[model samples]
Target: MAPQSNRVVELRIPSELGYEKIAREAVATVAHRLNFTKEKVEDIKTAISEACTNAIRYGSGSDARMKVVVILTADEDKLDILIKDPGASGAPPIDIDIPDIDGMVEGKRRLGGMGLYIIRELVDEAGFVEAADDDEGNQFRMVIYRVEDTKTESSPEASASGADNGGSP
Candidate 1:
């Protein structure tokens, strides 16, 4: 952890699968300093990895020349993760309902397209920033509140969740 004063940390890496290790390590370190539970830390690590992988695979299409920027902001009660894909055209809006976990685990449903679902499950809230048709970047954002134990809780905000509050125009 740099200093408690430095609430936001940024990392930019080539959009490749190999560099994902760095992302996981950085995220875990920050999350640990925030005193998140071990299980929560592991979940955040996994979710971040999945988000990065998806950004590389689907966003940049594994383009080595493109870049992925991960911004982690920690506050008194929550952590916000924003992943920007420089080459992504933004995901299309989807109207499908959340996948049924039982069916997914039972092999009755398709296996792909589970990253976003897993992210939504692991974090307090999840969202996407659609790039404009003329824009060059898209974003995936996640919000996780400090969950030291079952009794602790925090409120979710549109800004942190990247909801309809002008994350992208």
Candidate 2:
């Protein structure tokens, strides 16, 4: 369970502020080093941003301040990110299931629910956790895994799951 390398960075996101850029920079820093392609890196950033954006929405109200925590970690052959957010009402639990794309139409649909769908598609591995909030509110945990090769994934510990996707692999 030891990472080859890891970095934990925390930032305060105002309800009126956007946290996507924070996610992009943090993921890019370690992903580039882990040999993730430019496109793959972008996908990973998108996933991370989606989750953070939701945390800002559901966790904290516009006037309240929230926290964005990002951890960049890797082994010799893989990369994993652990991002945690404490919600506005404190951490509301996150549902891992992808949102229905059909019902969430652009013209008549919701704008905010696409993050969970996109996050699953972009990452090789994804996991979410809702924690008990004392003063911080709800907490959500997102883990994205990036392994170097398909061969390595055949082992007992495969991080990526295809349950919520649309045959992307």
Candidate 3:
């Protein structure tokens, strides 16, 4: 529930080691502007790191020089991210293998699929799309909803969607 007040920043990072720094800076600045809690800032930056890492590791030309685009938008109640990457070179399409959405493993996480997992855990709504041949490489979008609740409560609509309700699963 953003109060119709927020800040947004867009940065273009070339496929280089310094891309991570750009992402880090973007998160830091936006967090400061939004007055995000320390934990929220950490979550945002971490998610940004995963996104940039994927783009750099995957999107690039044979020349090993490419570009990554990162967009960060934050408000009093939400944070939205859009990341675009050409895609991993010479890489096969691999289904992202993640543990059940509600599961987590303490300190034994691998880097590959961990990004999406972490993003899901930290954010309220997260989604990714591989853009068409006509669009950018891989376009991923993640949204984090602000929370004021210490106890998790299910929305009626959400609960209904999961139940047979008056029909079937």
For candidate 2, give the lDDT. 0.55
The TM-score, computed over Cα atoms with residue i paired to residue i, of candidate 3 is 0.66
lDDT of each: 0.72, 0.55, 0.60
Ranking by TM-score: 1, 3, 2
Could you tell me how far off, in angstroms, the CA of residue 8 lies in candidate 1 after the best superposition?
A: 1.6
Off by over 4 Å in 1: 1-3, 87-110, 130-135, 148-169
Q: Write the per-residue lDDT of candidate 3 for residues 1-169, one digit (tens) a residue.
A: 2336656778878877656678877776776666667877787788777667766765554223677888888776767787776655533233334444344344454324565555544544555655666874666676665663421233433322221211100
* Candidate 2 runs further than 4 Å off: 1-4, 7-15, 89-111, 130-136, 148-169
Higher lDDT: candidate 1 or 2?
A: 1
- True-vs-predicted CA distance for residue 117, candidate 2, Å: 0.7
What's each prediction's TM-score?
Answer: 0.73, 0.66, 0.66
Q: Per-residue CA lDDT of candidate 2, range 22-111, in tens?
A: 767777777777677788788777876776666566655544454656565555655666555554454344344445556667556564
| Candidate 1 residue lDDT tens string, 11-32 | 9989989777788999999998
Root-mean-square deviation per candidate = 5.4, 6.0, 7.8
Best by the lDDT measure: 1
